[model samples]
Target: MDGQENEEHANRGEDVPATDRAPRPAPRRDGAGRTGRRALRRTGVILAVLAVALVGVVLGVLAGGRVSTDIGPFQADLSVAPAFGGGTKVDIPPLGALLLDSHDGPTHLTVELGALDQSRTEALLDDPASINRASQSAVDDVREGVLRLGLRTLASAVLVTLLLALLVFRDTRRAAWAGALALVVTAGSLGTAAATIRPEAIEEPRYEGLLVNAPAIVGDARRIANDYTRYAEQLQRIVGNVSQLYTTVSSLPVYEPAPGTTRVLHVSDMHLNPTGWQLIRTVVEQFGIDVVIDTGDITDWGSEPEASYVGSIGLLKKPYVYIRGNHDSGRTAAAVARQPNAIVLSNTTTTVAGLTIAGIGDPRFTPDKNTSPAGSGLTQQTADQLIGVGDQLATTVRSSPRPVNIALVHDPASAGPLSGTCPLVLAGHTHDRQVSKLPEVPGKGPTQLMVQGSTGGAGLRGLEGEKPTPLTMTVLYFDKDKLLQAYDDITVGGTGQAQVNLERHVVEDPQAGVPAPVTPTPTR
Candidate 1:
């Protein structure tokens, strides 16, 4: 073949060996290939700019994120930061922060009350009307502080982004773009945080502090709205309580509990509220309680869904003796019994903390759905069932070889038949606390019927009323002989209020060698 034809054949790879074929000339770049290369370069530049802008914005935020302002009579600094869950944190320096689950977002705003203007505070205190003015101005002050913070943050972000972009890219256009992008991101973040903020969260703030008296200093929040009168009273009470708590806590003596004395915590009507469990746990630890006795109404419906609340029993870490209430069912009893530390009583007697106790579950099961206004208080049918249960409990107490130190039931009336069978009969169904000396019966000793209030603040139903009910629990001091010596009724004010009143009542147990009952005194 001719040379030209041979070259064409080689180009086509038709009749040539691999090594004998001439090397192909380098292929010229096409429009599409050039376009792809340009696009990749642009993409790389954009990514590099974005990463630089993000770092610049973060550094800017850290530099100029916080602003100081006067909120009422207090001086505070406000700041914003990235967080997994959005919330407002009020940091009272040297004390602790109060966290409020205010909204759902990616930003956490913090208000640190750094100092109190003593002169302003004193003047405001002297002139009550100044408080209203200060409170009204607080919102404006906070708004101004936030606006200033936002402006500073944006300026810093733009300046930093521009400098970084210029230094990295050595191009004015890229630096401008980076600055603009940073501005947009910072503004959007601030706007989103402000838009999602929930001011109502202050009604239920959670305290995170170093001091053990934090709970006493800042009472548990439930739900409070539109009750400014109560709010003012609560604020005053909180100030007073804080002072008292600090004094008591600071001067606490190194002492030991009485020898052979057993502290028993009596709690009732949890109503499936998790907060009640927290309160119980705190009280148990604070008072060094040996045993816990729950009268009834651990749940409102006693349904399967409510059964999970009973699991908190095992967390108590102390012997938790319980009896079913009118709102509880057999299933609830079984659930309580399933807990590791729970001892369910259904017309049965048991020994705990060196004392023989007998208890009976309420026979009635009046869930919220089945409840009526008339039926809320004891009805004829309910009374009859209670009496029967009480009789059965009394029989259990009598059958026991050891004398029953305490008898537990759900209703005060049920405790009537249990009189004289045991020295103390505890019951709780009427969401009110009362102590009654039952008439003497032909048996061992005079019975004291102690009815407990709602420990869960009557649960969610508590919010239905004009005012929420305070959560209440009692601590009973039993002597070595298992005789009651004294007791403290702990009452925690409901939402909008921050008062924890602990009143002590010394019982004159003739067996305990006491002459008469001392009048109740408010401890704190």
Candidate 2:
């Protein structure tokens, strides 16, 4: 009956809602809908294909962008790639890299030294004209190599992009489009890099690897910036001179380390020079140093800003026992104490690397004009004040539970009272190295006093003299009894020179077997 009613309604030509009479012809999709669907699918496919092509191109560029060329006597490789920052990296293998903030972009350029022509380098030592010729040749080769590398890298990218596109789309036209996009990217990058070339960045380059040697390797930036030709000549001369010196040293006899000996590296008057750390690290590694002792003046000005220099103390990985110099402050001492390997001695005694040591901070804070005293004691403490401080330190050492093997003081003047209080007294404030026996003390054997020179080449102040001061450091060897056995004094030419000298000294104690009797220091 329901079916008959529905039929009747249909016959009446009225809308029939009863039980839905046969479904109306399925709605036909409009042309607009079809077009929209097709477009969405096409867009997805295009995006996916482009992503694949980009990956392929980048891989190809990274793999094939490098070119090797001869620069002077060195063989170097030049390469480029997309990176976070636009800078140039010069890598001298086994030493370190020089990062130059050359431009502002999204790419990186690397020049890596691969090899050196030994014969050419040796010949350069004697031939002046050849050095100039070689420099010019290097410049030309670098230019050509960069050009060739760019072209080859672009070609590689385009080829890889096209191949990936063809594999994904199976159409020549689409593949060509992808290749064109890659070509634009590679060409634009190369063009941007070339346009933004910053030759002046070489003037202030950040060095890596043996960074302390940068000044020696690159020469004075101001001088070099003024005369490129002169810089090249100087560079050539340095290489030749250093090579000769190395050859001479290599021919000398190698010293064997005595067994059961403790090695100590004594560095002083760093004056916030980074090179001082370099020298310290170098000698520590070469000499197998067990402990490091710095007398003072690690900073030019003992401000909070200079405190960061103490951070390197932990990097030494060995015990670093330090005493405050006249240039240091309580803030500086706190920074040093924060280091894991650092031990700051202030009117205190402690054992380090098996040797019991005591130290006293300088009585004066010279760099802080506001806090320092007036008159002769203005820059530093007067002789009287130093002697007073030394007496206090001597009393502390005398009361120590263990015998004091070493006593550290920043000023030699103050060390006067410390004499005979300890077997060895180390000081540095004079910027000159001296080893002497203090006047014989009643009932006490001879006491050795060692004054270290500026390990930082006297810092920037040294530049004021006719010649820059040489960097000095000493390696002290102590026997099982913690007595000085011998020491090697090493002096390195400051910036602008390539010279090194080493002198060895042996300490002969009159009574070698008997320990020096500790006596109460008489007040001056």
Candidate 3:
């Protein structure tokens, strides 16, 4: 009984000890909860600041007075400042620089920028890929830089607005509200002011100040830009007409001298007419021409700028033989040499398509200088100088092992001195088509002197007059033996009009046995 009692006592003792354990302290308020609340407040403050900054940036960009970028080849200056109400203004100086300075007097022209749609403007601002694919990255960089500048300006405005609000309101919450309200009001005012200004359907950006002294063509700049597409289409049509004309000439009986005769297309006095290229290309392809002979006056002034005009001749795939005229400057020869197919002849003979061709350039650099004898034709002084040049070339042609088959010159006076040296003598300064059998020289076959008319209808000079001169070109046929067989003369109406008339003349009938080859002799 005592042992059992002792066991119960031990159990009771342990239970008593457990009851003495201290009550768990009331659950301590979690410190993390306070920390979480504090963290949330900080996050809200940061977000609010970021939102305000974002708003300020956006507002600043919209209200920015002007944004400009110096894009390559052009300066894109956009003015958002209140102007003529609230319309945006874009000014580009380089846009007006494309005009050619081919006119006289002070030229004034205006172009409407609104002629382009919004999409075009956006494309131009963003990438300018349509105008030049290589400038896309540069354009994008410029746009971004302008936006960044606006952002910086907005940041400064926001800072100032916040300071002002704090000073006036004297309370943080009130200051924030005041600042936001002021920004809203300012943006609203700008928007309203902008709305008052309406954009013109066609707004010609003011370019007079920029172009007043620019050395460029003095024409209506606006018209050139607007009519650019029309000009391009006209060029295409000209090329097509050339192809058709060739087909027509091929079908003509007189154009074909024999089964395998060498056909030569003579073109001269182009005077910078862009149409001449297409015309030459078409004739070469259609007639299967063996060679092209240009007697000179390819350009009027033969200035450096006119060098680009000579590039058109490169389009012809056939061998092109050329000689400079009085109007063609020395620079013209340099440009002609750059052409892949051009062969510049200077008192030299070259064999082309089995025909010996010799040529001499004109002596005078400018044709206007010799106007003293314009009424009665070339003066004896000018004629003697031309004859001297012909004599010099005649010596070269007469000395060549291969008899010179054709002689090319620019002035008619030069043609007379080489009458018996070649069977066919070509000249073009007269700008009048003349084909005459030269008086037979004692011991030499009669030579046919052919003068080609102005291929460009006197070019831009013709526009100065009441009527433009007619465009003319000639096609000369040669037999297998390289003797002049027959020829066809083609004439077309003046600029802006297309009226082609062709006349065929038989120089030497093929059926009427080939005349003895002209014995080459030196001109006295």
Clashes of each: 0, 0, 4
Q: Estimate each model's TM-score.
A: 0.52, 0.54, 0.55
* lDDT, candidate 3, 298-360, per-residue tens: 987666656777887778878889999887888899899899999999889899998899998
Question: Cα miss at 382, model 2 (Å)?
Answer: 14
What does candidate 1's lDDT look like per residue over 86-170, in tens digits? 7888887444578888766666778988667989866764555555577679889988987887788778878888898899989
- Tell me the lDDT of model 3 at 137: 52
Each model's Cα RMSD: 11.4, 9.9, 18.4
Q: Which of the two candidates, 1 or 2, achieves a greater lDDT against the reference?
A: 2
- Stretches off by above 4 angstroms in model 3 are 1-254, 367-377, 509-524
Report the error of model 3 at residue 330, Å.
Answer: 1.7
- Model 2 misplaced stretches (Cα beyond 4 Å): 1-33, 51-106, 110-134, 137-180, 195-226, 234-402, 409-417, 434-448, 459-464, 471-524
What are the lDDT figures for the candidates, one per model?
0.76, 0.78, 0.64
In model 2, which residue pairs have backbone atoms overlapping below 3 Å? none
Query: What RMSD does model 1 have?
Result: 11.4
Instruction: Report how far off residue 252 is in candidate 2 (Å).
Output: 10
Residue 224 lDDT in candidate 1: 33
